[model samples]
Target: MPSAGIPGWSVIIPAYNEARRLPAYLDEVVAYFEGLDRSYEVLVVDDGSSDGTATHVLEAQAGHPAVTLHRLAVNHGKGFAVRAGMLAARGELRLMADADGATPIGELKRLEAAILAGADIAVGSRALRDPSVTRQVRLHRKLSGEVFNFLVRRLGLPDVADTQCGFKLFRAEVATVLFGELETIGFGFDVELLLLAQRRGYRVTEVAVNWADQPGSKVTVFRDGPHMVRQILAARRRLARRPSASS
Candidate 1:
């Protein structure tokens, strides 16, 4: 259980059956934040994973007081899980990260700096300046990602280079507002989140970070690709209809 005060940072991981890969990341998060001497909490939203993902987080909580678990009764998409964690977080700064740790946890310093420098949201970008570290995906996956970015730009958000990157940081107020209004409950949720943030006049910036393509990704070009496109289009329409908040 968290104390009454807000933590300095809240790390929210939307996990769905990531039992094998999640523990290492948890260890890293615990070690890194503890060493930094900042008050922090780690929330693992288990999206109804049957593979004992909740159990692992529970065990982690036993070892670390900063760790917590939220279990959904049924498997929801990544977007829903992330939304759950983001809305429930009690940190001054909230970060939503992939359970696979595609972007190393240490890269958070870059994002924290951006937010402190006046950006309301700082998102990880694989397309920005190169990093000493690189992640390799299949050639076809790489091509498909390019195509998806093209569609994302055409659909609405032209300024964002990579909308699907799984690492993003937000101020607590920003996270609560955007996520509270989220409509997409799937992979396209990131795109929608950024678009809404822009519409609300929030400063959003992309920061290049070390990223690697982890195995066991949930996205597939053939099956999920088309669904994601539909979600994007729907998000655009939904946002267009939404009354903008006063700047």
Candidate 2:
């Protein structure tokens, strides 16, 4: 139960086989807002982890009622897990962050401030010149990420950099609308969600945030890259066939 005070934010973390990381992430989030006067909820979508991730969450529930756990019966992709959590959140602002906490939870105030400034969506961007974090990632990962972004730009979501950043905040209303219409169930689902928001006349702002690449990520370089390319092409074609927001 939350404090009987104000309606606050929801942080949804979609986790899959991340038992090692979930405890630390939960602790960090809990400690980050320990003194804040607002309410904050953390939803962990355990996408069918065989590594006992859900059990760990359940065990941790003795002290953290604000932390909720949603278990998927099987291993769905990150997109599916995130969709489940966002749609289930009950806050004015809903944020889906990585389970590994790559982007520090402390920077959430910027995203919340963006929402207060009338932005419908706020996403983290590693491509910005001044970032809050700059270590822990392998150079090859950065190179491949740039290559993917170059290809993704061809789909016409301009002025948007680093679509792959796992930390993002959205107005709950906008999140409901966009996540409801999302079709992709994989990593490229982030791109699809952004494309849908852009088409709906939503004001999306990219905030330059600190990001530390965490080890033990589920993404495999060779396998996920080709699949992401296919998803981008599919998203482009789908958006091309639909009418724009003004229509």
Best-performing candidate as measured by TM-score: 1
Q: Write the per-residue lDDT of candidate 2 for residues 1-247, one digit (tens) a residue.
A: 4534334878899999999988898888877756687787888999989998988788766577778899899987988899999998888888899989898998898888888898999988888667455645688898998888887776778768889999999998899899988878889999999889888889999988888888888898799999877876787788888777540
lDDT of 1 by residue, 1-247 (tens): 3334779899999999999989999988888887886789999999999998889999999988789999999987999999999999999999999999888899999899999899999998887766455766678877898999888888877888888888999999999999998989998899889888988999998988888888888788899999888888898888788787754
- Residue-level lDDT for 56 in candidate 1: 92
How far out, in Å, is residue 229 in model 1? 0.9
Stretches of candidate 1 exceeding 4 Å from the true structure: 1-4, 131-133
RMSD of each: 1.6, 1.9
- Once fitted onto the true fold, the runs of candidate 2 whose alpha carbons sit more than 4 angstroms away are 1-6, 131-135, 243-247
Pick out the ten consecutive residues of candidate 1 with the lowest summed lDDT: 129-138
